[model samples]
Target: MSLHADAWSTLASWRPDYYTQEALRQAFLGYLAARPDACQRSCAAGHITASALVFDAGGEHLLLTLHPRVGKWVQLGGHCEPSDSTLAGAALREATEESGIADLRIDPVPVHVDVHPITCSLGVPTRHFDVRFAVRAPRGAHPVRSAESLDLRWWPVDALPDEDGELDMMLAVLR
Candidate 1:
């Protein structure tokens, strides 16, 4: 199946744990039904993005990157690629690329979804329909900071600088 179809099927079959998440899932399905090119960045209105919240081997620390463009600490992820076959795969790929850490294990199930506006590489403002997943880092994992980020570090989950509580929300739904 196509990546777009995989996204639709995934969301359609997922049973969100919260009412808010259910609403987001419905919104994603509706958006996908209306826009065939919704997974592509060229959609102009918005596009699907895959991201991962990386947990340490022991699950105490969460890896985050200070995005150079947004200048805010955010999870590792980006726009979906044509080569991606599944949303989980796209998210895992992004996490590996941004964190520079291999052998990360993805949950396959979505942990969260968000919509936000940004002027990305397209040079115009657009909304990002973000699909988030949980990923586990290997033991003694050493992260290499990518040029895409201003800084990369593992922050204690309890003391995260998540101003919007996005990270907390992602973690909360899992438990």
Candidate 2:
């Protein structure tokens, strides 16, 4: 099946835990149906972005990136690339790229979905239909900071930033 078809199937099969999540899932499906280039960065209307909450081997620490533009410690993820064939693959690629850790293992099942506004590099405001999954780092994995982030660090899952509701929600589902 095509990547676009695969994405639709993934979202269709997901059972969200909250009303908002279900709404987002439906909205994403609708967006995909309406826009053939939903996964492309130039999709202007809106695009599907993939992200992953990466945990260390012990599962005690989560790798977060200090996003330069948003100025928030967020998960490793970004726009879907043309080479990506699946949402899970996009999320894993983002995790590996942003964290500079190539040995990460991503769970194919998404843990959460969120829709939020973002200013694209082209200076256009667009919504990102974010699909989030859980990914695991290799044992003794040490992360290097990539150019995409101002800094990269591992945080205790319980002590995540209070303002990051997305992280909180993800942790709630993961735990």
Candidate 3:
């Protein structure tokens, strides 16, 4: 199947309750179904993407990307391209590309999957069905900023800045 077609099929196959809650899942699905363009581009067009939450041993330190757009400390991730065969692979690719980490190991199970509306720099509305994975970086591996981020750092999980609801949710799931 084509990338777009596969995305649409994946979205259609998701049970409403399979997401966080019945109401939330239904609402999101309903919104997607309402907009044929969004549905088509998001699912069928292969615009869906994934991310990773890389944690240090003991899970006390969290790896975060200094997003160039938002200028906030956030997880490493980006759009899923055709090269990525699965959501996990896409997320891992983003993690490696953004962080410059070569030996990263991502947990197969998704820690969480969040779908939300995003307006990029061009002010175009797009949906992000972020399949968040848990990953571990080799000890002493320090990530350098690529074009996607301004910096990369390991922050104490408890000392994260108070911003971005998605980051909070990601941390909660990691805990």
Candidate 4:
């Protein structure tokens, strides 16, 4: 099926009150509809995963990863495995594995839900239904990078690497 069709299907499964979710869904659908070959395969049917935009207790900094694939700084997240019963569980797992921080805790509420299409290093396209949660880490918690990231650091929320539009969007959400 087309990416637009897949986005619509995914959006329909989510709660409609979330403006970010709807907006992202529409944006992705529009992009896909405009470019049928944007992605190698439609990820509309893939299992959704959770992610954390973790900030220190001071809230002045946010944990970010320089992704091994995209080579962009982003929140901690990955695919949902069959063992993960909930999106939050999958996100927490990815966060701990990638960042090597065991004390991270997500707030009870979700910060945002975003659905976006990404092209892998091989130029294969896939969709990610990222349920973003807000989290607070203990002061002075150091991050250790895993294979998924080239580097991991806590960046000041006000100062982020200047790059693509996607980074700006993510920063806005993180802010």
Q: How far off is residue 130 in model 2, in Å?
A: 0.6
**46-146: candidate 4 lDDT, tens digit per residue:** 32456888788798888899887777888888765545545555567788888888788875445566666766433566566566667778778888889
Looking at model 1, the pairs that clash are none
Give model 3's TM-score versus the native structure: 0.74
Pick by lDDT: 1 or 2, better one = 1
Q: Which stretches of candidate 3 lie over 4 Å from their true place?
A: 1-46, 121-123
The weakest ten consecutive residues by lDDT in model 2 span: 161-170
Sort by TM-score, top down from the best? 1, 2, 3, 4
lDDT against the true structure, each candidate:
0.93, 0.89, 0.67, 0.65
> Per-residue lDDT tens digits of candidate 3, residues 1-175?
5544444555455543234634544554555456444423345422355788987755777789887777678888877675655666777888888888788898765666677667654357766655578888887887888887788888887887647577776667556
TM-score of structure candidate 2: 0.95
Error of 2 at 32 (Å): 1.0
Give the C-alpha miss distance for residue 124 in model 2, angstroms: 1.0
Cα RMSD, model 1: 0.9
- Worst-scoring 10-residue span by lDDT in model 1: 166-175
User: After aligning candidate 3 to the native by TM-score, how far in Å is the CA of 138 from where it should be?
Assistant: 0.6
lDDT for each residue of candidate 1 in 20-134, tens digit (9 for 90 to 100):
9999899999999999999998999999999999999999999999998888889999989989989999999999999999999999989889898999989999999999999
Q: TM-score for each prediction?
A: 0.97, 0.95, 0.74, 0.69
- Write model 2 residue lDDT over 1-175, tens digit each, in one string: 6678888999999987788788888989999999999988898878889999999999999999999989999998989888889999999999988888878998898899888899977589998888999999999999999999999999998898748587888788766
Q: After superposing candidate 4, which stretches have Cα over 4 Å from the reference? A: 1-20, 23-45, 119-124, 165-175
